[model samples]
Structures are given as structure tokens and as C-alpha cells.
Target: MIYQSFSSIANAGEETCLNCSTHVVWIAVSIDGGISFTDYQVYIKPDVTVGYGHQFVNVSVDQAGSVYLVYNDNHNMFYSYSTTFGQSWNGPFRINSSPSNTAIFPWSSAGPAGTLDVVWYGSSYYDGVNPPDSYPMTASWQVYFAQNLAATTPNSKWSQTTASGIVHYGGVCESGVTCTGNRDLLDDFGVAASPTTGFATIIYTSDQYVNSANEPAQPFGSGGGCTQSSTNSVECSHTDIAVQTGGTSLLSATTKHHFQITKTDFEQISNNPSLTIQVTNIGNEAINALTAQISGLPLNLPWTPALSLQPGQITTATTGALPATLLLAVGTIYTVTITANLSDGTTETQTVSAIYTLGAGIGL
Candidate 1:
């Protein structure tokens, strides 16, 4: 199957203004390996300004067929995922770790199941928030990368780092042909992981300073011979690639530390309520040790006994019984977190929550 994403402009007038125009993201799924698409849907409607919001929309599918879509809006990167073949999506989660840096041209690539890598042009000085009509972009840009090893989990953590040196030192107007300032780096870049090595390779455009002599020069705006004004300099237009040197490999046949957690209530034992927590190794890899912890109850329980779980194995452990006399405040919620320690020296967690009512049973 193939997943594709693109952007569309809405509420356009004969002459568009920054606030008047809006941008949206659309997605399509192809079962025949991109030969033809049967389902086309609009995932996100026009919410932000048309210029930067919907630019550089990209999509990638993981080994398990989960689709990931990423885009930039308001100088920030947003990501969403779909597992049911584009029938529904999880979020428009902000993936950029940096709050102040400007993120643009976000591109994504899925590696192993639940693993994803994203690359974009990030700038320290330019937040890309100024009015479009007034050219307001000015800053130094670099290739920034972020990865989520457990992307399928809720509130997954993303690790971010700088992938390359300064690529450009100026304002980047993403306002298409009507851009007023520098649009030198163009629009988007690309990222992909090697199936064999599992390392990510990023292909991007660079405008870093390089003298006509084909050697390193000073910084772009620092009176460098290869400044943007010197259009003749080769540094003004060049393509470069960055390869991951040290990191976890994205290529794993078995889903790395992937599991599912389910909590079920058992009948009252000795007039005390009891709960059963089950964990299933849904991935191909076997979990070396599995444990669970429960919180938000009258009494919190520590980690449960470790259990080895093989692929497709489901194991259950009982939680401490709660006495009927114990008083739980209104709207009391119980949280169960299941953790899996993989054989590869990595750990993953899945959590479930249940709310307790006065007379009614626990609702998950």
C-alpha cells in the first residue's frame, strides 16, 4: 500500500491576503503500490494561514502499514497517524522539540513498526510569524532531525538534534511566487532510512558559504565572499546529504519493544474489588521482561513480577484488591502502566486508565 499527502488552498480571492487564505491537508491511500488510489480524504481542514500552514505536506508508511503525515504551520511541525488505512487518525501532535525555533518543509520517513524519522529546515532567528504581505523572514537555517522510536504509543517522546551545519542565512518566504524575500532553499527536503543499515539519510538543499575557489568560506551574512548577494558563487545553490553516524538502527524485523495492555475487572473477592491486567506481545520480538504498575488508587502498587512474553503471547497479573470501605474521591481515576523490557536493552510502555464511580463498575 502507498500513502500520499498534499495541501490545498481555500477561501482564495482574486488577490489573496495573509489572513483571508487558508490551507488544508488531504490524504489518499493506494493498495496497488501506488498504481491507483481508491480512497481520498481530507484529514485536516483550513485552520491556519494558507502560506506556511499547509506547505510541504508529506506522508510515510511503516512496516506495519501505519501511516504518518507531517506538515508545518505557524513555524511549527505537526504530525498525525492513521492505522486503519486512513479511515481515522490519532492526532495533529506537535513533533518539533524546540519551541522557539522555526520549522519548515517537514518531511517524514517510517522505518520499523512504530519508528519514524522527520527532517526539516529549522532556523533560530526566524519564527515565520510575521504578516505575509510584509516580508518578515530573517535567520540562519539548518537541517534539523527528530525521531520517535515508539510512535504508536500515546504521547510518544521525540528526540531532536541538528543534522547539518547552517544551510542558509536569510529570510525564507514560503508565499510561493509572491514571496518577497529569499526563497532560496526552495520548499522541501527529503529523508529516508536504509533498510540494511537502519540509519537515516537526508537530502536537502544548502546555501552555506563557499568561495568561488571551491573551498570553505566565512559565514553567509558575515561579509563572506559567498554571501547570498553573490549569486555567482556555487554555495548559493548546492545539494547535500547527511547520514546518521550514531543512533539506534531503524531496521528491525521484530517491532522494537511493542506491546499492548488491557485491563479487566474481576468479580469481587472477599467483598474487595480486584483487577486483572493483561499484556500481549503484539510485535515479532519477544520481551525479556514484562511488568506493570498501578497508580491513582487508594493504595498504589509497585512493579509487578516480571514475566517473559513471546510474540503473540498474552499474560495476566492480578492487582492488589481494593477494600469496599476505602473512600475514593469523586471522579477518581486509576492508571495502569505496562512496561516491556526488550532483549535489545530497550524498554517501552503502554498505559490504560479507568474511572471509578460510586455504584457503577470501573469504566475503561
Candidate 2:
């Protein structure tokens, strides 16, 4: 299934909505193994009347196929639900856990046979005014969560939970306290979660709980500059949720790099060989180095050769290492080989080729 930012109307990640010119839309196609697919698109519009009134990001559908959406409207948090496979819909349900308002982080997941858990960062006000409960802390919302498996979509009972998120007290404080702070500190689609035997658990970021390093009651300077009541302006804080899975592995391509070189007319020494090369890292845990070897040569002239390269695994970044220099003997051509050994007890080799014109001795 493919998801996007509401612009893929004609599909292929291109389409956009005509009404309201809003790009907040979604489409999905459920593929059956390698056979066929069930496709559809459903638009979610916020109701300015009842709900908090805003758009949402990050929507999740459980095994039974229930949809939960979260977003921020006017700096405030708002939520909504969708059943019937996203056919018709329902009004936005208020998950107001912020003080003044907040920009919803918009992420959710459901247990294998359990309930759906959604999370976000914002004020923990609960009250519809300025003085919030915890002041924009981490919050969680669970719907129809029970010790047992789920029976259907949109479970009648859902639970909401909010906390002050963890705090980091800097080792160096004016009065023996370590501290730092930040909200909306993260942006990405990766979070730690798991579901087992109808019971699901999740770990997310939060900075709600305000605890002083010296002790729970002992504040920095004992509320020297700012009173114990207003800690937001004094202490520094930021929270990140690390959810460890059973195990994880890094990609192979990240350990190696690639580089390229090119040559043109008047650069060839002679055309007697068309070269193709491949490299090998005889014995090593990683390809810590890359260089060209031109044994059948006349002079120490750089090949300025063009090399072809291929990577082994997927990566988060688009850059890789390339060859810096290649000196070849014409007709003798050259083979640019790459060898690598990774930390995971693995190694591989890739070769590239180039052609040289005969009798041509690098004419000026």
C-alpha cells in the first residue's frame, strides 16, 4: 500500500484534490500476496463546528481494518475515527490534552488482536484555558483496549493517557541539577511497538513529568530565580522515546563507498584493449578502502577511466564513495574492482570496465 501528502489524485503519487485545493488526502491498495489488489481512496475533512477543527497526519488501520487519525487544528490537538473501510465516516473526536494548543505528531498502531494506541506531544492542560496541567507533555490514546482480542472495528471503549514525559537534568546546574528541554523534538515515521496475544505495548517520547535531579521535591536553587510553580522558563528539557524491538540489523551498503572518473579524445594512449575490472577484499570484516590496480602498464599515467558500480542494500542516504583515480595502459584496458568486508562477517566484490582505442598514444 502507498500513502502520501494528499497530492496523489490521479495516483502514481501525482494527483491532487480540486476542492479546497487541499493536499491532505490518502489512497490505498491492498495486495493479496503476488496475485491481485483491492484499491480505494478516502478523504477526511475536519468539521469546524464540533471537533477541535484541523487537519491530521499519520493514520493507522488495525488487522480488522479500523482507521484512527490525529492532527492539530489551530495549535490544538484533535482526533477522529473511521470505519466501514474508510467508506462514509464519523465526526472528529476531541483528544484535547494540550493547554493553549499543539501541533499533533500524528502516529498510531494497533495490537495484533488488541486495541489501537495513538500518541502525540502537546500541553497536558485538559482545562480549556491558559494554566495547563503539565504544559504540553507527551500523551497517549488507546481505544477499546482489553486484555483479550478485539471483536470488531471501532471498539466502543477506548482509553486516553497523558504524562509529563521524562526529564534530563544536566550534570552541571547552578544549584546541583542537570537540565535540558524540547517539544516537537522529533520528525519521522519510525517508532518502537509490539503486540502479542491480544496485548499490545508501545514506547513513545514525552517530557511531562517535572522532576529535579537532587530529589523530587528539591528544585534547582530551590526555585531561586523562578518559583517552584513556573519551571517551564527555568529548566531545559527534551524527550525521545526509544522502543527496542526483538532485534535489528544495519544495511550492507552503508559500510562501502563509490567514486567515478571520465576520459575523452586526446586522452587515450592507444586502442589495443577494452578493459573490465572487479575488486575483491580477500579477508576483512569491511571494505575500508577503494583504489585501482593497473599492473600491465607502460608509465604511471592515470587511467581517468569511467567505472560502473552497484550497491548491495537499501539506505537512508543517497551518497556513496567513488574512485578518485585510475591509470591504465591502452588496449591493455583496465578492470576497476571493489572489495569490501563489513562488521557482520560478510564481504563482496564488484567490477567495472572501459574501452581504449588501438595505436592511439594519448595524442595532444
Candidate 3:
């Protein structure tokens, strides 16, 4: 699981082997501009039986630098959080209140103001059904959502809600002999949150009706008017992607910082090598200042002054034409390193090496 934070990149995965008797979840954080990462264990539990659904792990980062992780274990959904940037975790709390039902494919997102939302599919009725206390492998499933107002708080309870009308018409089989055409909702779901509005959009796949077909004539020995023969069998089911929004009002405004260098170009200007670097503020919030530094050249580059870069906007900084003495010789490699320093104390760096060559008349 890869997540983007205000000032860093985070990821979560199983540190140990999935086939091992015991499995653990590890979260890694890259604060030095995503160049290196530090990892920590979030939780550990007994591995699920082989041939079961895949273990899906998800991670999200809030505006305040808190990290949230959710995964499925033992046919139930659970979540844990880290406040110190993956240094420590708070809980393996079960999000689903019902112990008898199975919940899987958890997807989590964080709002601008530190709110966390999680959605999953569970063995519950599609319509309004309180306390989903039944466990039927082949039963219908519904979409469920939970909200955590204070994600960093320890042992915080999640407010649960069910999105009605969506149904899952699939099942898991234990043995190959009893396997039907039923399929498992493989891997994951999607969820996104707007940093400006705090509105969340959840998308998932469900087996809805695909088409209708006429019934086939049945034989005399058969007790039905129409038989489900191979020719007339209606495998008319589709894994449809459905989208839903959380019913919540907009939250307060929050500040975010995301600075990145989108592209870099190197060329010869007037027979002298030159470089141009483009930067962007890929975050929801604005950046006040960013500085660039170039290395592997004799010339001293100046820092870019306080630059206000809005989201999706790009800014370019170039190295002026080199002196005549700095002209490159053919068949020689030159290396350069460019570093961008944001006002928020975060730095991003890029390195490039190019082999220089003159026109056809030039010789090495």
C-alpha cells in the first residue's frame, strides 16, 4: 500500500511471509524526500487458511501527519493508526461490531481535518439490517462504512453506516470438487477524499444483473418447466463498479504541503551545456517557497527565492549558459544533481548523467 502525506510518502505491507503461520503488517515512512524509508510493525495475527481471499492492506495519511492502516484477518476487518509517522501504532480494533459476519476488502481515506473513513463489503443484507449477526458463506453482501472523528486517539470507536441497494452475488468454495462458477471479489476497492471539501467518494465492485434470457424446455423426467441446461444457463452477472458518497457536512479548512519536480531537461545552449528543472505543487494546498540547488558543476547556483506555486502549476528553473572553457568534449559523461528545498523543511532531489557529443565534424 502506497500513501501520500503532506511532507512524505508512506507504504504498508506484510513483513513476514503470507504463508507463514504468523503474519505481520509493516508501515514504512520516507521523510527525506522519498529517497529512503524507515519501517515499523503495526500489527501481527495468525494467517488465514490457504486459498482464502487475498489479504488486502491499505494506508492513508492525514493533514496532521497521522498514518492509518486497515486490513482483513480471520474473515473480519481491523484497523490501526500511527501518530508519530509510523514509529508506533495504537490498535488492532475490530471495525465491524458483528462477530458472526465476515468483512473484507477494506478501503480507507483521510479527510483534510484528520477524519478517517473506511468502507468494506460484509455478509449483511442489502436493505436496512441492524446488527448483522449472521454468517452464511453463500449469502448476499452489502457495502458498509465507518467514520473515525479523531483518528489519532487511542481506542476510538468508529461510527458505522451501511450503503443500501448494492449486493454481492458471489461466494468462496473450500474444495475444488464443490467449486461453482462463483468468484471472489479479488484484491481491493477505491476511496478518495477531497482536502478542500472533506467529501469522500467510495467505489466498489458488485455482481449485479447483466442480462435476461428466455427459459429452455425441460425433459419429461425433469420436474420443472424450464431447465438450467448449459445452453440456457444465464451466467448473466457483471462485476459492476458502483460509487457512493458519505453523508456528511463539509469540515473546516486545513493546510497541506506537497512539492515535487515533475520534469527535467538537458541541452546545449550556444555550444555550452545547460539544464532546466520544472517543479510543481501536486498537493491540495499551496506552497509559499521553494529553492533549487545544482551540483556536479563548477558554477555556483543561486537558490530560488520565495515562490508561491499553486496546485497543478509548474515552475521552471534553468542553469545559465556555461562559460566557453566549460564546453564539453565528445564521448565524455557529465553528472549533475538537483535538489529542491521547500519552505516546510522538506527536500526533494534528482540526479542525471549525460554523455556529451558534438556535431559529426568533432572527434573524441
Candidate 4:
């Protein structure tokens, strides 16, 4: 777990706060999947030059179990990672491609081995208001995204892009619960990767112009899906999802073939033996033809007639009734290989294990 807190001192064996200037991010690890956590350790403590210290500390763990840490320090986004869970870290790398006057509320999601995606609110101009201000931040802000396909590598180049249109025309205060200005955006938004496409999907809030007059919404004054009237002046905030259109996928596919085994069925009968496999096309492109064959049974099943499958479609290949001599042993484990041929001229292979029982059907 990660948190932000003021600095502390050991005053006669009692911990004492040392003022807000020493604010820092603390981290605690739970080896047992969060059942319990280790003692908190100071993770990030920015220098006095940045002032006000770091806020909104976030973390993400990749497929390889590397943990990524992100936070906003003096209007800039910074990140670090630990291959050792939280034991050791290896970064202080910057996330934004260009310098920004204000960047805050950073959130990150990890994907396939060594890939990570981050999103945060940012603006080219700084409103110049210190936290806990009575007014809202006045700088126009938009959601920004930074992706690193080789995140495990130190200082890997990050691909930066704008994730959303200007979300707000005014400034966003970073001083949670303290500043009174335009806190409609709250503190943070989040981002995640698509399981099949590997693309980054970000969910954020927006208060867009609602009526034809282009009136901004409430907090910005009577706009956004509202009827700009004395009684009906409140406009609802929008929860939006930004999908990445072009970029290297977080789902890193080593093979061009993008199909997956969805289901498999096996039957061990004396005279009516059958085995079927289901494959789903998960890629953006359609498969003109697909065929499959299974091996490791008493008799290897021959490849079935080639069939076509559209993107996101699931199709089945079956080895219909075979000769009675093609018997399967009950209570015996069998590791089977399924090879699929795609029209794209790529062949994909997968393996599965199955066991048959006298009454219970064959389990795959």
C-alpha cells in the first residue's frame, strides 16, 4: 500500500510531526496478498527545491511482478519501479515528454511483460495558486497519457499523447479538501489496458458545454446536459473512457497469431469417441481460414476442414466419432497438443491436459 504523510521525528521515543514541508510518500508491502503489511517505509521525499513535496502516490505491478510507483512533485510527474516488489527500486524517471506547468493526479496500469501506461491531468500553463487556496485552479487542463513498452529497462523512451480534449478551462487544485476552487474534478482519474487489444483504456471525468449557447456546466456555471435556467442550472459531470487508437499494445504478443483456446470437450466412449476444441479470434483482423488437429490421444486426430472466423468470433473443431479401437484409458492423465492453422499463414499451437473417469465425463 502507498500513502502520503507529513514528516516525523523521534521526540523522547515518541513520534512527532515535523510540519507539512516534510511531506513524503510511504510504502508498505503485504507478501500475503494484503492480509497484512510490513512497517511503512519512506518511499519518496522530494527536495525543498520542489516545495510542498510529492502527492497522489500510485503504484502498478506488471505481468513479471515488477511494481511501478508514480507521483506528482512540484507540478511534474515522476515514476520509479521495483523488480523486488517493494524491497528495492530503480527509477526517478520522468513521465511527461515535455515540461508542464502543472501535472497531477497520476494513475498507472501495467500490462504484458515490461509494458506500462499512465494518465494524469496536465496543463501547459500554471495557475500559480498554492494548495489549500480558497479558489479553484484556473489553468485549462487535459488528460495526458504516457506509455512505455519497455518499462523494465531503465530510462526507456516513453510515448506521450493527449488522452482527452480539454477537460476543464479553469485550474484544478491539488490540495485535497483544503482549496475551495473548482474541485469538481476531484483528485484523480484512472487508466487500464484492454485484455484482448492491449490498448490503453482511460476513464476520466469531464464537465463539457451542454447547450447550444456553449455555456460551461455548473461550477463553471449552468452548462453540460443542463437547461441553463434559474431552477435547472445544475449540469451533470461526465465519466468518459478514452481508448488508445494507435500505439504499441500493452498486451505484447510475441506471435502474430492472436487467437485463444476458449473451450475444449472430450468424451471417452467405447463406440462414440469425440473431442472438440473452441478457438476465438481475438485480433482486429479476421481469419480467412482456420483448422485444428489434436494429438496425444490413443489416435491422433487429423486436422479438420479449414473454416473462416471473423474477428472476435469463436469457432469449434471437432473430431467426430472415431473407431471403437480408439479408446481412452480411465483414471489416466493425458497431455494433448492442439495445433491451429490460420489463413494468415501462421500456425499456432497449444497444449492441454485431460483425465477420464468411469462415470464423470472427461475433464479437460
- lDDT accuracy of residue 80 in candidate 2: 44
lDDT of 4 by residue, 1-364 (tens): 2222232221223224334343344456643234455544434454423432433677787644567878776567877776654666776788885544567788899875567898888777644555322224355678998888888789888888788777766545566777555566665489988867788888887655453343344443444243334221115455567888876777654235466655555555443445666666766656665433334434334323345667778776667543455456643434455555566677666655433322222221
In lDDT terms, how accurate is model 2?
0.33
Poorest 10 consecutive residues of model 2 by lDDT?
168-177
lDDT per residue as tens, model 2, 201-299: 333332223455622332333344333454433332223334323221111111243321211111232432333222322222334333333332221
Score residue 145 of candidate 4 by CA lDDT: 88
The C-alpha RMSD of each candidate to the native structure, in angstroms, is 13.5, 18.2, 12.6, 10.8
Per-residue alpha-carbon lDDT of candidate 3 for residues 1-364, written as tens digits (9 for 90 to 100): 1343211111234334344433556676543334456567677554332111234577887644467888765366777887555767888877886622667667888754347888887764322332222223346677787777766677776777676344554353212334343343434467776644566666654434323352223332233322333222223222334344445622422223354444444444455555555555666555655543333444443324336666766676666554445556633444545455555656655444433333222221
lDDT of each: 0.63, 0.33, 0.53, 0.60
Worst 10 residues of 1 by lDDT: 355-364
Predicted model with the maximum lDDT = 1
**How well is each residue in 58-103 modelled by candidate 1, as lDDT tens digits?**
8887755567888776467888887655656877787876632678
The C-alpha local distance difference test score for the whole of candidate 4 amounts to: 0.60
2 versus 4: better TM-score goes to = 4
Q: Candidate 2, which segments miss by more than 4 Å at Cα?
A: 2-25, 28-56, 75-91, 97-103, 112-114, 124-155, 166-184, 188-193, 197-239, 242-364
lDDT winner between 1 and 2, please give it.
Answer: 1
TM-score of 4: 0.59
Q: How many residue pairs clash in each candidate?
A: 1, 61, 0, 7
